[model samples]
Structures are given as structure tokens and as C-alpha cells.
Target: MSGDRGAVELEGVTKRFGSMVAVDSVNLSVKPGEFLSLLGPSGCGKTTTLRMLAGFEQPDSGFIRISGEYVQGVPPYKRDVNTVFQHYALFPHMTVAENVAYGLRQKGVPKSEIAAKVAEALDMVQMSKLAERKPRQMSGGQQQRVAVARALVNRPSVLLLDEPLGALDRKLREEMQIELKLLQSRLGITFIFVTHDQEEAMSMSDRIAIMLDGHIEQLGEPETVYEHPSSAFVAGFIGRNNFWQGVATEHGIRADDGTEFVASRPEEDVPNGQPALAAVRPECINLSAERPADSNNVTAGVVAGVSHFGDVLQYVVSVKDRDLLVLTPRAHAARFQQDDNVFCHWSADDVYLFSARQADIVMTDGDEEIHDN
Candidate 1:
């Protein structure tokens, strides 16, 4: 792939399947050599957008350009990009080396040079020792590495991955995440990764484009999105949060449970007395056995549940018939038992206030556990 590549541009991109619009009028610009992730829940059009970029699907009413060249009607084989899907898709009969060399052979590359390129690609993914193994003989992670090698073997300027780590176990997935990130940095190639996994997107991407209902919801660095979410959906989707439904008050918001909150840095402006939703991250909340003094953000609750997650402790505090989740470091964990009285307090700076206009899109605790699909 050429190192001197230009930006990838999508202008008014839209795609539809029957009555449903898979992708809306979306516009995006990806910097050269940038790692950008398309993140959202299932049916949010993340995969469709990536397919459009890979030349597997065409936009109904938009234009796409790769490396400064318009690629209308271009076939996947001809596009200057490669796609790696969740499934390995490798031929069961073919060895890893043969699978990695398939594209070169199909394109009629000189046999003299094919082996060298295959070796280079396999080495890039650290799969040289398994080059002779078939897909069925290797673990999911190994097969995934070979699949990635096959894509990289083509030397495309851009790589599009659709939840490439979704098939692995937690530990293996995390290991591959680190490996893929390091590989991308070494190559400096443009990577447009599509995943529903928030942690995956946050850890591997330079910037994340959170999509919702076929449209781009928010685009920014992971920290920016997590600290200052643009909408209730963005705040709820990017990380764990406790939400309160209420009406906007003069200073903050009045919850349906009769608790009021003040957000020192509200991302959006809402008229006074209007309905709104407030969110705060679990780690931002401080839990204690004693009531906090002189704080409007403090609420009385009882410990409903406790979960230990290695280095962190998660608490479910029941306040006013609502179960609010709170996270604390294991070292700083408060010894509160189920049914024990507790106090939850947070600073105004840690609160996120959003207009109730997005309540329908924002997820709640009752919603299915949000994961990258």
C-alpha cells in the first residue's frame, strides 16, 4: 500500500434495505493513516457503512472516495481497501500460507514474488510458525491472525474490520486487541474498524464515530466522548452510567424520585422546568455509610448488591426503589452489606445532563446488556 494516501471521504451516504434505511445521509472524513472506529449497537448501520467503504455495498444517494479517487461501481477486488469479517472465512482445505497467498495468485502475481510477500504478511501478524496449519487446526485467535494476514497481504491502503475480535474469549480478545493496535501503529495504514464493543473502540481507535439509527451520533476521541457525551444515548452507550429521569430545574434537574442534581458542566442547554435526563458514571460516585454534609447531590440508599471485578468493586445501591450502580477501586471499597444504609454523592462536575428529547434512544438498566454486536 502507498504510504502517501489521501483522506477517505463519504458525502451524503445513504443505504436502504426495503423499507428500512440502513445508513442515513452520513458524511465523514478520515485522516490518512488514522485508526477510526464505527461504534454502536446492533442495527445501527455500522456494518453497512463499512461495507460501503469496502465496495461490497453501494450507497443509494452518496459518493465515496478513497485515497482521493472516486470509486463508484468499483468491485471489492478492485477497491484500494480490504475487509476482515468476524468469521475467519478461510477455506478449510487451504493452509495458512495458501490462504494468505490466495489473493496474489488470483491477481496473477509472479510466483517468484508471491512466497516472499506471503512470508512478510505472516510475519507481520506473528503467524509464521502456523503458516502450514489449516483453519480448522488453529484456535480462533490464530485463525483471526491468518485472516488479517490475508487482508494485509493485498497491501491495501485502507483496512476495514467488522468486529474482528468478537469471536474470541475475553482474555484472547484483549490480547488480540493489543496486537492489532500495535500492528496498525507499525504500518501507519488507515483502519476503519466497526465494532459494538465500547472498550474495544476506546482502546484501539484514535477517534470513534458513534452511530445511531443510521446516523453519526458523535465523533471524537474516546476521552472526549466519555467525559462530555453529546447526547443521552452517547453517554449511556459509551460507558456504564446511572440515569435519573426528571424535569429541568432552575439550578439543575428534579428527578421523578424527588432527588435534584446539579451538573457543573452540562453539555447541552435546556430551558428551566423542561423534562431532562441526568447521568453519572459509576466511578464518579462516592459511597459512604455517613451522610455527606452540605451537598445537594447526596442521596440516601441501601446496598442492594456487590460485585468484585478484580481491581474494582461495583455496588448496586437501592435508593427510592431505583437501583443505582456505583464503582470504586478495590483498595478504597467501602464495606457496606446488602440492606445496609449508605450514602451516594457526586460532584456537579461529574454529572451529565441531557435533554429528554433523547430518552427514547438512551439505554436504561432494563435494556439488554449493551455489547458490540
Candidate 2:
């Protein structure tokens, strides 16, 4: 809208639907030209928040600013933002070029100018060669490219992407992730991506706002949030970890089996005597025939399960009180078989501690959380 910082801000943003509060009072800020993601499970208000930004929905109480200008009442058509939806909602009767030019035509741009801009937008998405093709004639990926070109053709300062790659196959989704990021960078536009997919958000966003229950649970750069989760929800949501139910002590945390896990961090800062959760990723666990010398957290466990993931081998090991996960590099020459007795050792630095704030998660049956780390 104005200048390049592509700044987007939300202060005390609250949205309500009848008796239900879809988005609680939330605060967020995005730097100009930054790729930020609203990441969480369904019903977490990510889509609602995005719709608010695009002016399709209004917040009950909040201020939204784009490019440093307040846009509380500005409608979608007047706002300098373009949306690329999950479905490639293209016009069936129009070719890619015509679809892209539709917006400019509605604005009544000169015929010559519209043609030039349409060609440029298609070229920007590497879809110029297919400009004459209709949406039904193209693959999912190609159709989505046309959608992207249509959104970009408007030259909006901010791009709002609502799961733009959700319809593609796995490999194609991954490829589009990289490609879309490159396009965002090359165009230097501010992008706000919404998704329930953790990996997609992690791969593309400069910063991720992890949301839950109508609030943002954590917001940070991908690596920072992954390595230093601020809450139990984050530690369990971000990455695969072996979780242990425990009680907090001043020195460390005591697992249910009475095994004390001393992390590089302390449990004293956590409420003493409260239920706690300790987690460590599979790759952080060390596997050996015997306990590693000078290891702080080591356990004897049986290989409960093992699976090959190309470059890495993932193992689920059952210790006396806790089930630990161990990830071994495929390059490692040593191998273990299922049911083999082994010692799993991990450094304190690899451990994360959290309060048992989500007892409900233990009762849930399905794995709906993204676990972005």
C-alpha cells in the first residue's frame, strides 16, 4: 500500500461469532516484506484472522494496519492486499491470460496495458508459455500457478495465502513450497500465509505465530521456536519427541518411573510439585550397547520399533518407565534389531521441560496437532 516495509499489525484483535469467540484479544506485528504464517490446528482462528485481514470478515475489537495505514473499514476491493486461496478458483471459461487480466479489465485499464501486465504476471510465475491454456486443461500445479499470477497481477503490497498448495499431491506440494517462496522473495512482497500444516509453515515463513484456542501460543523464528519452545503445547506441537509424564522438582523433573531427568535447564523455574512433561527428539537420543561414559540422562531399553526413512533410521525404544525415540543416521555402520536390549543416552542440552497444561491432549484419540518442530 505504501512504501516497502510491508508492515502488518494487529492490536488487541478480537473476532466473535454469536456466543463463540473465534479470535481472542491477540497482538501481532509483521515486518515489511516478511513472510509470516498463522499456524495452528483447525478451529484455532487462523482462517478467521486471515479473513479479517482480507476484509471479508471484521474484527469485533482491534486495529489492523497495512503498510502503516489503518484499514479498519476498508473493503477487500479497496485494500491493497491480494488473496491466493487454497482452491485455485479460476474462471472455467477464460484462458490463464484472460483470468489474470480480469481484475485489470474490471478496473478498466487500457487494452494494450492489460495485455502487457498479464504477460508480465504470467512470466513472473513461470507460466507464460501456458498463458493461452484454460484452467481445466492444466494440472493442479499449473492451475495454481495461474491463480498466483492472477493475485500478483494486482501488484498488491501484501499477499494473503490461505493454504495455496493444499490441493496438490505430496511431491508437488513440496515443490510448490520452494517455488512459491522464491516468487515471494523475488517480488519482495509481504506475505501472510495461513495453514494447519506445520511443515509448510516452517518451510516458508520468516516467523510463525503458533495459535491455539483463539490465541497465539508462541511466535518466533522457526529455529528459535523449534529449539526453545516456551510452553508444553509448543514442545509437543513443533517436533517429534518422546514425552514423559513427570513431577517438577527443584533440581530436575522426576518421570513417572521415578527416573530423574536433569536437563541443561532447571525445573525450579517451573511450579514445584506440579505435573510436568519432559521431551527429547529422536535424533538427540544416543543408542549404544552400554551406557555412554559421562552421560547425564541414560537408559536401558529394548528396541520396540525401527523404520527406515532414507537418510535416517527411526527407532522407538521402550525403557523401564518411558518410551524413548532414537534417530540414527543411515550412514552409521552400527545397527540394532527389534527387541534388542540397548542403552539410550542423551545429553541434558537436548531435553525440554514443560508444565502439564494440556491434560486434555492425553485424552484425545487423534494426532491433529501439527508439531511444527
Question: What is candidate 2's lDDT per residue for 264-297, written digit by digit as tens?
Answer: 6742256778887777778888898876797568
Q: Which regions of candidate 2 fall more than 4 Å away from where they truly are?
A: 1-5, 266-268, 362-373
What is candidate 1's lDDT per residue for 1-373, written digit by digit as tens? Answer: 2443736899999999998999999999999989999999899999999999998899999999998888899888998899999997999999999999999999999999999999999999999999999999999999999999999998888999999999999999999999999999899889999998888999999999999999999999999998889998889888888888889887788988888898877778978888888888999999998888957799999899999999998899998867889999999946777889999999998888888887766763324442211
TM-score of each: 0.96, 0.94
Global Cα RMSD, each model: 2.6, 2.8
Q: In model 1, what are the clashing residue pairs, if there are any? A: 196-372, 197-372
